[model samples]
Target: MIPRSISLAIILSILLQCARSSTLDDMTLMLSNMPEDGRLQFPELANKYGYKCDTYNVTTDDRYILTLYNIPGDTRRPVYLQHGFEDSADTFLLRTNTSLVAFLVEHGYDVWLGNMRGNKYSRAHESLLPDDLQFWEFSVHEAGTYDLPAMIDFVLKHTGQKQLQAIGHSEGTTVFFVMGAQRPEYNDKVKLVICLSPVAYLHHSSPPLFPLISLVGGPAASAALSVAAHGDLLKNSSVAVDLIKVACTQKLLSYEVCAEGVFFTAVGRDSEQFEPEFLPIAIGHYPCGSSVKTGAHFLQIAARKKFAQYDYGLAQNKLKYGSLEPPLYDLSKVKMKIALVVGKADTLTAPKDLQLLRKQLPDVVNYHVMDWEKWNHFDMVWGKYMYVFLFNHIHEMLTKYYV
Candidate 1:
């Protein structure tokens, strides 16, 4: 006769195996049934909504080929929209008619969407391929230094305009600050900059997972480095996206559980603003691929609590930055007219950090915090009531400066 404990363990293992099989089956079914619209790229997605979208490839000074998606308008008032970390140009078009891109198009402003290097839309380099380790060895610092200037010059030259308005969300905002500070000459080329959920000094970052991963000598940090050493993380692939959509949207895992684990925990919780129906589409495009180096850079910022260049240890720091510590990006050098936006519930960009940033910035023309209590970081882009809470305010700001 078998012991009760041993028999129970065997039975439990059998049940677990069955559950795993069930989940796999469900995911396969879900992927097979996914709508065709969920697979459309940015250009096709934009065109489907009755917008004439044009694609432009601009090679950065560093030889990184970046893609710019343009929705042409009657006016020469071009507005450049830069996407946040792990996202691509498609981010702006996820909400259809109510999207920020649509809002800009309706207002008759020429819209140019920028895809930072390492993202799926802009992954090519002149000499190195995506598979090469050297090609993925860039952070937001490089994007600001090379990619932004290249794209900005291209946009200005293409539009035959001296200046253009810029809008950046999250890492997008960081790169803009980097460009303005590192390449101060380009500051004159931009008329105004709207920083949404700006991330500069991350001393007070509230995300629970961030601190765990940012710890210098911690296991999480070591694990992150190991993964990053492999090359690109979460590179956009339809199969991978479909699997995520199934896990997040289908009954394999409840949407609330997925959102809480993935979105809410990382940023902030705002259930009312999050639309369940958009989950599949959102999953398909987002986490659009980035180098582990870029993520490591941000993690260093969170860990060190300073907006400084990537730390390459003592010997390497001396060789690269010419100091024991990475030098801070000079905020005072960012002399362009700027507007700052924040969310009350955003954990990633805490209010305290923004307060410090405001003091550092030389000229902040406007500063506005979302009135809604539950407004979080992703809400700036994915919220259902974004038009009411964010877009109108953005429109007003553009009109104030440009119109």
Candidate 2:
């Protein structure tokens, strides 16, 4: 006796209500069961997962104090792992048993994790506090020129190794490439360099936020964010972390929607591979912090579509580099045997940009694209299948190249 349209509408309403109620219940359960240990600092988390972690402070040439984490192994083969943008040494420790650090340690390879300056773990300076504006004046340029060299030297000296194999993910790869191009001497100190989701030529980047900023101009965006955050952006502030936790894990929004909107938009979209349980811990540690200048540099690269030094505008560029524009980092100068692992779905590092990078690098030992179509940018560090898809290849490379 009911009209068909009315009945259909009634059914749809019931289904919608059921879906919302189910989402709320799932969110509640996930929050209650969220692992507290994931929120711990790097060393503590590593220890919780049954791995012995050692912390060392290395001073950069520019006097920035960086924190380095080491997972000791019986062998003299030291492998350095550097994290990506707005991340810390904790990036490698997030996956617990299947983590890259754990895999390397289990294989009897010494692993050292590098935390770049301005991150939560490495914000100390000889004279300036993190609150000081001068302390925030650095970009990836300083990171590559100073942080990488300092950490590399410290690890080599501590292990008494002449050379080490280096693995870098995202911005980590950028810094390594910068070191190789600028301080070519350090290239000899590294036996092999493996780049994961490498980000050097970012003009083809597809991230909406990055490209928007690129359109507005890097300097303007940098200035705006710097002014708003007082030189530090998203550096694991309790307020920001709590808000993110609520947005991503709370019952107000479904976990899938929040994850897709917040994290997946920046990194690639791969819901199946992304561990929902790890979301709380990842939110607590990530967007760990970086200077406005560092972000501006990347935005500049994205806008210009060139792998070059920081752009200080015309006057400053003239004063600094004696030119009206920034100078390009000569990838041809990087003579070390380099291998690249890229995700086909990575939005931040496009295939066209990767081609540009490949065209420039002098010695590319290997170039690999993930077989899985959904493999993404963050998956380099957070993917659940990393051991099966990524680590095995790395192990083979170590066997082939590490001498």
Best by TM-score: 1
- Residues 1-403 of candidate 1 have per-residue lDDT tens digits of 2333443354354345444665666656655544455678999998899999999999988799999989999548999999999998888888899999999999999999999998889989889998887788888899999999999999999999999998999999999899999999999998899999999877877756454544642324533573556658678763454445555545433345556555776798887877666766677677778987787788778787788888777776888888988899999999988999999999999999999999998989999999999999999888888999999999888888883
In angstroms, the error of model 1 at 324 is 1.2
TM-scores of the models, in the order given? 0.90, 0.89
Candidate 2 lDDT trough over 10 residues, lowest sum: 1-10
- Off-target runs (Cα >4 Å) in candidate 1 are 1-29, 214-229, 238-242
**Distance (Å) between predicted and true CA of 88, model 2?**
0.8
Residue clash pairs of candidate 1: none
lDDT of candidates 1 onward, in order: 0.82, 0.82
What residue runs in model 2 are displaced by over 4 Å at the alpha carbon?
Answer: 1-34, 251-254
